[model samples]
Target: MNKQKQLSEVTELWKTNKKQYVKKSSFSAYTLLIENHVLPTFGKAFHVEETDVQDFVFRKLESGLSHKTIKDILIVLKMILKFGAKNKWFEYTPFDIQFPTEREKHSLEVLTKSDQKKIMNHIQEHFTFRNLGVYICLSAGMRIGEVCALTWEDVDTDRGVISVSRTIQRIYVIENGIRKTELILDTPKTKNSIREIPISKDLLRLLKPFKKIVNPSFFVLTNDARPTEPRTYRSYYKNLMKELHMPDLKFHGLRHSFATRCIESNCDYKTVSVLLGHSNISTTLNLYVHPNMEQKKKAIEQMFKALR
Candidate 1:
């Protein structure tokens, strides 16, 4: 009988094979998941069964991991198992994992229009490089990483667009038993994320003068060669909100606020999806298209009137 290999052994083999095909960011993510979650649970096992995976899911849930995060971990786990099976290191079994039904809908945080306007006004008046980054986010639905990666060359004043092609993130790397963190400047989250969003007139006015003289290679947020990572920027944003006496919304709420305002203005969902660089229109719809009570009543009234 062939000796069954330990899961940890197969995992190292899989990583070596997987690294060549994936982006550095993706490879880093896979490695982190394996090291932090998968290896800890199943490294010593020769094979994992359905019950083992299901129990792991429950434990992850109890530890307050989100459903999406658990699902991502499972995707990595399944790939490792498949890799092991392909190499004849172990027998592979597919598991059916179940999650508790969610009774309450997840509410995304967003800024009220008045509050959004107040913040924008403040940024315009009290302009700083960091404050300008917040203004850009509100005007253009840019993620923190994307904003961090922005440079003067990406801002085209003549075309009135901001080109989004890259993002900056700190990733965990493990090499020869040494773990360290790396800050990477890589392509944005996905292909669709590499897009040009039209610059709003107000933001354009704010940027046009700077475009003339700023170094093309300088990062927009810093106006220097050094780029700010998301962690530092997020902390800056938190303090700005607190100083403004506004609700402590997460930095992502700036994105939600931009999308919500677009929807409220009755912009077409497909256009909003493209501007937001969503991979699919369905994602945009799901996040921003919830009908309010007034809309439901109005819809019913119009339906009855048409029937009559």
Candidate 2:
């Protein structure tokens, strides 16, 4: 029998291969997961057993890791294992892991329409480039990274659209046993995320005059060549919320509020999905399509009418 190889050995090979194929941001994420979670647990193992993985799952849960995060860890682990097996250095074993059922339905936080309006009204009266970023997110449903990456060139007044091609984020990188961070401007999360969304007339009016005068290459948020990273922008947003005497909602709630408003306005589910640049309609339906009490009552009435 051939001698088995250590998992750490397989991981190094896999990461080298993975780095060539994936974005720098993606490679960074995989490396962080592997080093922080996978390597310590299974670096020396020649083969991973199903029971060992199950126990690892339970331990991660006890340590307060979410099921989704643990699942991501397993995905990276399996890739390393598969790579090792293909080289005939380790045995391949498929493990079917189960998670405890979650009974409580977690609701997404969204801003109330009045609160959303308050912020918008304030921005319109007291306009600043930084505050406009929040308006754009609320109006167009762009993610924080996407908003941070936006430049004047991406906004087209003639077409009344915002072209979302890239996102910016700071990622951890490890090189030659030295760890550091890098801020990268890369393509958006998925191909679907690289899309064009129409701007609302209100926002379009605000942007049109500035589009002609501002440097096309300058970032929209800072009106400068240098872009603000998401962390700094998030801090600005938090302070803005406090100044407005609003509830302390996470920045993502602005996106949720936009999608929720679309649903409330009776927009078609697929249109809402496209506007939000969701990879699938199901994602939009899942997050923002829960029927209200009035809709539920109407649904029941229609069903009874058919029966009668």
Candidate 3:
């Protein structure tokens, strides 16, 4: 009979094998989650029972982790467990974890039309390269990292489009009992995230003069070889909001505002999903396409008309 191996042993082996296939950012995420959450609890265990995982979920929830975050941790945990099973180091047992039903309905935060207009108008009136990132995010719904990663070369004024291909983020690295964080430039979040967004005529006019003067390789936000990271850019945005006397909102609120505006303008859900670089239209509909009472009434009326 073979002796069972600790999960930590299998995880180290899995890490070495998995590192080559995944992006650095993804591997870093898995490492962080494993080190912070999984190792302390399950590293020494030769077998992970379903009850143990369920308890871990409850404990994480009690510690104020969101369901999504807990799920991410569990995904990494499952991968390690599966790897252990494949290598004959542990018995395979599928976990069926459950969570208590969440009662509170979460709502997305977005800027009001009036506040959005104020910020846009202010940026247009006092144009700067850093400010251009804010404008592009509002107009094109680019994520902060995507806008931070943008280069002058990505914006084609003649073609009237902004090509999005990459994103920048800081990630944690752990090695030999050492921990450090570093910024990395990598491909977009998903394949769908590599997309082109049309530039508004106003934005094109604002960018035309600079297009001829700036180096094509320079980042759009910095207008230099160096790029401003999302954290630094977020601080700038917060200060701008303060100066404009706008209500406090997270940087991602700009994206929500753009998507909300598109839905309000009667844009088709699929087209809006594509424009926002969503993997599928269902994500767009689930997030942005909630029907109001008026729309529901109209839908019912249309059904009666069809009956007639």
Candidate 4:
């Protein structure tokens, strides 16, 4: 019988082969998850038992990792195991891992109407290129990376749209016992994420005069060939919030604020979903749609009326 290979050995082999197919950012994420979590737990094991994995899951949870993050780690582990099984280097067993039911409902952070208006008014008055990204995010619901990647050429004043095609991110790279980070410009997260968002009349007016003067190839945030990374842009946002004296919220809250305002305005779900570039309408509904007491009462009344 051939000797069983340890997970550490198979991981190195799998990574080498997988690197050829995945995007740089994805490969870096897989590598980081493996190095930080999977390898440490299962590195020497030739076979992983379902119970062992369940124990790992519990430990991770106890350590305060989110279920989503722990599941991502498991996905990488499974991929490596499957690769090993295909090559007859290790035994693979399908595992049914379960997580404890979460008691706390996850809530999205969004800016209040007054706060949103205040920030927009401030941006309009201050009007710097960097500040423009924040305004664009509030109006268009673009992700930080997508906004960071935007160049003047992607903005169409004539057409009244912002083309979202690319995103920028900094990812960790590990090679030969060395670790470093690289900034990469990559396609948006999904095909759906690449779409055109119509510019509001107010935003279009703000952008019109500047559009003719700025170099088309320069990024909107920096107004330069080099783009600002998400981390740096986040720091800028933090300072802006402090200066505005607004409640502390994540930069992602701008996106939620846009979606919330759209739903409140009675915009159709499908249109809102498409505008947000969600892969599916369900994602939009799940995140943004929650019936209030008034709506719930109306629904119950309508049901009773139908029964009568």
> Roughly what TM-score does model 2 have, to 2 decimal places?
0.94
Q: Which candidate would rank higher by lDDT, 1 or 3? A: 1
lDDT of 2 by residue, 1-308 (tens): 65788999889989988888988998898999998999999999988999999999999999989888999999999998898898888887999998999776878788888999999999999999999999999999999999999999999999999999999999999989999999999998789898889999999989999998999999999999999999999999999999999998999999999999999999999998988889999999889888766679999999999999
- Model 1 misplaced regions, further than 4 Å: 292-308
TM-score for all models, in order of appearance: 0.95, 0.94, 0.94, 0.94
For model 3 the local lDDT of residue 112 reads 79
lDDT for predicted candidate 3 compared with the true structure: 0.92
Runs of candidate 2 with Cα error greater than 4 angstroms are 292-308
Pairs with steric clashes in candidate 4: none
Q: Model 4 shows how many backbone clashes? A: 0
Clashing pairs in 2: none
How well does candidate 3 match the true structure in TM-score terms? 0.94
Ranking of predictions according to TM-score = 1, 2, 4, 3
The reply for model 3, stretches above 4 Å from the true place, is 292-308
On residues 207-292, what C-alpha lDDT tens digit does candidate 4 reach at each position? 99999999999999999999999999999999999999998999999999999999878899999999999999999999999865
Cα misplacement distance, residue 55 of candidate 2 (Å): 0.7
Q: After superposition, how far is residue 174 of candidate 3 from its true place, in Å?
A: 1.6
RMSD per model, one decimal: 2.1, 2.2, 2.8, 2.7
